[model samples]
Target: MEYICSVCTGAYILGATGLLDGKKATTHHLALKVLQEKYPEIQVISDNKVVHDGNIITSGGVSSGINMSLYLVEQILGKTAADRTAKTIEFVH
Candidate 1:
């Protein structure tokens, strides 16, 4: 199954479940340090708004959730479908 964490805090759930162990992930910039400290097994990235490792998709925050959504749509459907969805939602990306 695919997992999409809309915000940094949501990653905690995945981390707690050991799904993020040894994988590259990301969260809100403000929580980057804490996330890293909390889950030393996870490679918490701070420079990305979104991180996709295997079936897991993690975003930094609410705004980045848009990008993550589009990415998921693109992955599941196609770029055209994702672009159409973004356009319908009036999202730039």
Candidate 2:
């Protein structure tokens, strides 16, 4: 695939085609290298606890996905709502 030519673009090629262009995102650290090389337009920030570039939000790893998801929930429903969801999901961090 042209999109994943550089890295493991296969991971999110569909997402990229649909929503990743002109946005920011990150993938699993193991997939970082290829992502960077393949998608130079994407701001591949490896240091972010959670990378949010407009509509494209990418987490470093599975654990980070929880954080990002909570952040989104908090944004939409406020901290109280997010906290409740986190608690319901048993997400500690």
Candidate 3:
């Protein structure tokens, strides 16, 4: 299963489930300290928009989520398809 962190706080859920153990992750700046303090087993990254460790992908915040969505479309489909979808939605990469 692919686990994506919507915000820093969500990392706790993933970490609690053991999916984020020994993996690099990040969260919203506001939650970084608390997340790291709570999940010491997980490596917390700072000043990052996104962090992908294995099948788990974590985004910093809402905008990062949108970027991740577009990136996933490109990865699962292709650049052409992603571009087409982006154009349709009027979202530039």
Candidate 4:
């Protein structure tokens, strides 16, 4: 199954489960240092709003979840569907 983490802290939960080991991930900018310190095995991305590695996807914060959701939609249903969904929701991206 695929895992999508909507918030920074959610990545911590996945990390604890060893799902994020050796994977690229991200969290809230403020917590980036903490995440790296806690999970040295994870390559914490400090600049990305969303990070996708394998079947797990992690977003920086609440707002980035929107991007993550759109990405998931595109991945599973294709870009046309994702674009329509974004437009229907009045989301700019």
Candidate 5:
């Protein structure tokens, strides 16, 4: 999920609901600290543009959202399909 939004409230809500609990996730660099504090159960990983914890996938900023989508497409479809979609969106992954 893309956690870039107003303040860190949206991200905090999602994480607090256990969606991100016991999962490795990330958010916009600016919100990392808040994320960690709000969701202590979640392992707020940094140093990555994208972090996937099983069914729960978390992304940093808007650009990272694009990357995460490409990752999901590649997982669901084949690499060829993912490549095509990325190309259509002018994104490289």
Candidate 6:
């Protein structure tokens, strides 16, 4: 269920939706600690490249959105598809 893409502080919205409760999630590094303190129900993760917990996929920064997208493609469409997508898009990572 990694189809969801919640990036940076945008996870705040998802958190408000109650979708992040009890789920390991992440957001901008600057907001990581506060988001956790603000929502103890959410197992906020930080200092990672990306985070995938159940249906939610969160990126820690703007650039991490690409990594998160690649991760989602791999989860939903297979690694080969993800690789192809990345190659086709000239993704360096």
lDDT of 5 at 49: 74
What lDDT does candidate 4 reach at residue 59? Answer: 93
Instruction: Please give the RMSD of candidate 6 to the true structure.
Output: 1.5
lDDT of 2 at 43: 66
Roughly what TM-score does model 2 have, to 2 decimal places? 0.72
Q: What is the C-alpha lDDT of each candidate?
A: 0.87, 0.65, 0.79, 0.87, 0.74, 0.86
- Model 5, residue 52: C-alpha shift (Å): 1.0
Kindly report which residue stretches of model 6 are placed more than 4 angstroms away from their true locations once superposed: none
Candidate 4, which segments miss by more than 4 Å at Cα? none
* List of clashing residue pairs for candidate 4: none
lDDT of 2 at 36: 70
Global CA lDDT of candidate 2, please?
Answer: 0.65
* Count of clashes, each model: 0, 1, 2, 0, 0, 0
Give per-residue CA lDDT, model 3, range 12-40, as digits (tens).
Answer: 78988988889999888888888889989
Give the per-residue lDDT of model 2 (tens digit) for 1-81: 012211223326734574666666777788777777777776676776577665455677677767877877776779999
- Over 4 Å off, model 2: 1-11, 14-18
lDDT of 6 by residue, 35-70 (tens): 998888998887775898877788998988999998
Off by over 4 Å in 5: 1-10
TM per candidate comes to 0.92, 0.72, 0.81, 0.92, 0.82, 0.88
For candidate 2, the per-residue lDDT at 3 reads 23
Relative to the true structure, candidate 2 has a C-alpha RMSD (angstroms) of 6.4
Model 3: lDDT to the true structure: 0.79
Error of 6 at 3 (Å): 3.2
Q: Model 1: per-residue lDDT, tens digit, 1-82?
A: 6665657678888888998999989988888898899999999988888899887889997799889989888988999999
